[model samples]
Target chain A: MDIVVKKIVREVKRGNQDAFAELVDLYKDKVFHIAYRMLGNAHEAQDVSQEAFLRAYTNIESYDENRKFSTWIFRIATNLSIDRIRRKKPDFHLEDQVSGTDNLDYHSQFAADIDLPEDQVVKLEMQQWIQDEIMALPPKYRSAIILKYLEDLSLKEISEVMNLPVATVKTRIHRGREALRKRLGQA
Target chain B: MACTRDKQQVINQYLDEEMTLLESKQFEEHLHSCPDCEKHVRELKKTTAIIQSASHFEAPKDFTAGVMDRLPKQSKTKRWQQWIRRHPIVLTAAVFFLVFVTSLSAGFGAEEEIVVRGDGHFIINESERTVVIPEGSAIQGDLFIRNGDVEVNGEVAGDITVVNGRHLQASSAQISGDIEEINQTFEWLWFEMKTLWNDAVPFLTPASEEE
Candidate 1:
C-alpha cells in the first residue's frame, strides 16, 4: 500500500492533479474520523478533511517518499482540527448544530454490515456518548486521546504528528483517559 | 501506600500496548493486589475501547471534486511574489538602478532639505517638509521624495517612492505604477539589499526584466 501511495504521490508531484484523488480515497475515512472526533462536528470534519487532501496535493513535492504517508497526512489533519477547536467559541459544538442528520449520515455511510439493528443502535449510542466525552476534554488531551485510540497511531506517531516529545504524548494520553473514565461512568 | 500516579501511568501504557512483557507481568500482579487500581484500569480500558469502536465516516462523495475546484489559481500578487523569488537578482538590480537614478535626479546637494525628483511638477515647501503637485500638473518619470510628505493633485507616469515619509493623493491624483512608502527599518534594509543585489547579480538579466 505504501508503494502504491508513493506511486500516486510521484504522479501528483509531476503535476498530475487527478492522481491525488486516489490518495484522497485511500485516506479519507481515517482523516475524516480524526477530524470528526477531534472537532465533534461532521460538517467541520468534512471541511477539514477536504482541506487536508487539497494541501497534500499542492505540497506533494515536499513529501518525503521514504517516510510513512499516513503520518504526514495525519499531522496536517490533526493540526487543522486543533486550530478549529481552539479558535471557535465553546458554546458551538455543545449544541453541535452540524446538520440534524450527521448521525444519520454516519449510519448510512456505514450501513453495509448491519448484523443486528437492535445491537447496532445500542452500540452507536455508546459510541456517541464516548465521542461527547472526548469533546469535553481540553483540545490538547482530546487530540492525544483521539489519535492514540480512535486513529490507532502509536505514541511515537502521535508525538511526531503533534510535534511533541514521546514522554509528553504519553502523559497527555494518561490524563485524557483519566478524564474520560470519570465522564464515562454514567454509562 | 497506594502508588496511584505510577499505576495510572502504566494503565495508559498497558492499554496502548506500550508495556513490555516484564512490565505487563508486574502490572498484572499489582492490579491483582490493588482493587482501586484494578477498577481504575478497568474503567479506563472501557473508555479507550469505546473510542476505538467509534464509527468512521467517508468524506462526502463530491469532496475530491470540491477540493480540485478550490485549488488556488495563483493570483496577481502571488504571481509577482513568485517572479520576485525566481529572479531576485533582476529585481535587486532594478531597485539599484531606481535608487541611482533617483539620487542623481534629486541632486546630491538637496540632502535633508526638500528634494522632489520628477520630470516637471510644482511646489516644494522646504520649511514644512512637503511637496505638492497642484492640479493640471504632470510628471513624466518616477517621483522620489525623501523625508517629505507629498500631496499629488495631478497625474504621474511612473512609480512614486517616499523615503522615510508619506504620500497623500487627492481625489484626482493618478499614478501609473506602484506607490511605495519606506519609513520602517525593515523596508529600508530591503531597499539597501536591492542595491547590493543589483551590483552582484547584474549578469542574470537587465534591471527592467523584473516587469
Candidate 2:
C-alpha cells in the first residue's frame, strides 16, 4: 500500500494530474474526520479538508519521502484545524442546560433537524454531549486525544502529527482521557 | 503497594496497553485489590469508546470532486512562471541564458559528429553525414547541424547553429543571418531544455480551453 501511494505521488510530481485524485480518495475521510472532530462543524471540516489536501498537493515536493505520507498529510490537516479553531472563537458555550440561550437553540435546532426516534435521539444527544466534552479540551490535548483514539494513531504517529516527543504525546493523551472522564462524570 | 497517585498514571498506560506483560499482571493484581483503580480504568475505557464510536464519519460523496475542482491549475506554461516566482535569481540567470542561447545555440554538447535538422531545403549526403546547401539554392528558416558538417553554398534566411560540427561556407554563400558554432555540456543541457519546451508547447492548451 505504501508503495502504491508513493507511486501515485511520483506520478503526480511528474505532472500526471489525474493521479492526485487517487491520493485524495485515499485520505479524504481521515482528513475530514480529523477536522470534523477538531472543529465540531462539518462545513468547516470540509473546507479544512480541501485546504489540507491543497496544501499537500502544492507542497508535495517538499514532503519528505522518508516520512509516512499519512503523517505528513495529517499534520497539515491538524495544524490547519487548530488554526481555524483559534480563529473562529467557538460561540456555542453549553455551560449547563439552563444557561446560554444560543446554546439551547443550537441543541433544540439540532434535535429538530434530525427527526430521529426517541431512543436514537437520546443516543445522539449523548453523542453530542460527548462531542462537546471533547471539543471543550484545549487544542493541544484535543489533537493528541483525537489522533490517538479517534483517528487510531499510535503514540509515535500522534507525536509525528503533533510534532512532539512520544513521551509528551503520551502525557497529553493521558491528560485528555482524564479530562474527558471527569467531564462525563465517570470519575 | 501502588498508591492511588502513582497507580493513577499507570491506569492510563494500562488502558492504552502500553505496559509490558509483567507490568500489566502486577497492575491487574493491584486493580483487583483496589476497587478505586478498577473503576477509574473502566471509566477511562468508556470515555475512549464514546469518542471513537460516537463520531466516526466519512467525507461527503462530492468530496473528491470538490477537491479536484479547487486544485490549482499548474499547467505547462505556469511551470516556468512558478519556478521564477520561487527562485528570483533563476529568472535573472534564465533571462541572460535565453538571450544568449536564442541569438546562437551556445550550449555545446559532446559528440562531434554530423547531425542536421531543419525545414530548410538542403542537399544531403547521408554517407558523409554532411548537409550541403547548393549554391544559389534558397534555404528557408533556421538550420541546426550537430556532430557533423554543413557546406552552406546557398541563401539562409535565419541563424545556422552547429553543435560539435564544422561549417564550410563558400565565398559566394549569401547568408542572411548569424552562424553560431557551439560545443558540449551547458549547451547540451540548453539543447535538451529547448527540445522539451518545444515538444510541450504544441500540446499546451489555454486554461480557459479546459473549461
Candidate 3:
C-alpha cells in the first residue's frame, strides 16, 4: 500500500495532475470522515477536506515519501479541520448538537448479521451515542482517540500526525477512553 | 506479583495493549479478583469498539475534482505566497527590522548639519548647528531643514520650511519663495504617515499578492 501511494506521489512530484487527483481520491473519504466527525458540519468538512488535499498537493515536493502518505495527509486534514473549528468557535465545548444522521447504508455490512431491523436500529443509535461522546471530548484528545481507534493508526503514527510526543498521544487516548467510559456507563 | 499503583492506569494500559507479559499477567489476576476494575475495563473496551465501528461517510461526488480545481496554479506568486506562509515569523521579523532601520534612518541623522551650497542654488549652510543661506547665493528649490535653527542670509528661489527649530532670515536675504515654518499638528501626522508608508511597502506586497 505504501509502495503504491509512493508511486503515485512520485508521479505527482513529476507534475502529473492525474496522479494527484488519484491520490486525492484515495484519501478523500478518510479525510472527509475525520473532518466531518471533528467539525460536525458536512459543508465545513468538505471545505477542510478540499483544502487539505490542495495543501497536500501544493506541498507535495516537501513530503518525505519514506513516511506513510496517509499519516501526512491525515495530519493536514485534521489540522485544517481543527483550525477551522477553533477559529469559528473559539470556546468549543460539548455542543449538544448531534446533527449527523445514521447513514450507515454503505457500512451496514460491517455490522453484525442481525436479522431484526430493530437490532440494527439499536446498533445505529448506539453508534451515534458513541460518536457524540467522542465529539464531546476536547479536540486534541478527540483527534488522538479517532486516529488510534477509528483510523486504527498506531501511537507512533498518531504522534507523527499530531506532532505530539508518543507519550502525550497515549495520555490523550487514555483520557478520551476514560471520558467515553464515563458517558457510556456500564453498557 | 501484587498490584500497587493506580488500577485505572493498568486498565488503560491493558486496553491500549501496552502492558508487558508480566504486567499483563498481574493485571489479569487482579482484574479477576476485582469486579469494579473488570467492569471499568469492559466499559472502556466497549467504548473503544463502538468508536472503531462507527460508520465512515464517503466523500461527496466530485470532491476530488473540486480539490483539483481549487489547487493553486503553479505560479511564481503562488510559490511566493507558500514561502511567506511557511516563514511568517521570519517575514514579520524582516518587516520589523526594515521598519526599524528605515525609521532610524529617517529619525536619526549625523550630528553634523547638512550644508548645501551652489551658485543660483540652495545655499543653506548648517554651520554652528544652523541652516544659514549665506549672502548672494540663491536656493533654487525647496529647502527643508530639520533639527537646529535655520538662518537665511542670502537669496532664495523656492519654499523655505523649517521644522523643530527657529527660522532666522536676514533682511538682506532675497526671497522669491514662501518662507513657511510648518509646525501644524496635521503636518506632523502627514509626515508620520509618509514615513510609515515608505517603510511598510515591502510588507504590503505579500498581502497584495494574496489578493
The models' CA-based lDDT, in order, is 0.80, 0.81, 0.76
Identify the candidate with maximal lDDT: 2
| Residue A159 alpha-carbon offset, candidate 2, angstroms | 1.1
Candidate 3 CAPRI category: acceptable
Model 1 backbone overlap count: 0
| Order of models, best lDDT first | 2, 1, 3
Error of 2 at B201 (Å): 43
Using Cα atoms, each model's DockQ against the true complex is 0.31, 0.37, 0.39
TM-score (chain B only), all candidates: 0.43, 0.39, 0.37
Q: Show model 2 residue runs off by greater than 4 Å.
A: A94-114, A185-187, B1-3, B76-211
DockQ-derived CAPRI band for the predicted complex in model 1: acceptable
Q: Per TM-score, what order, best first?
A: 2, 3, 1
| By DockQ: ranked, best first | 3, 2, 1
Candidate 2 docking quality: incorrect, acceptable, medium or high: acceptable
TM per candidate comes to: 0.56, 0.62, 0.57
Model 3 captures what fraction of native contacts?
0.91
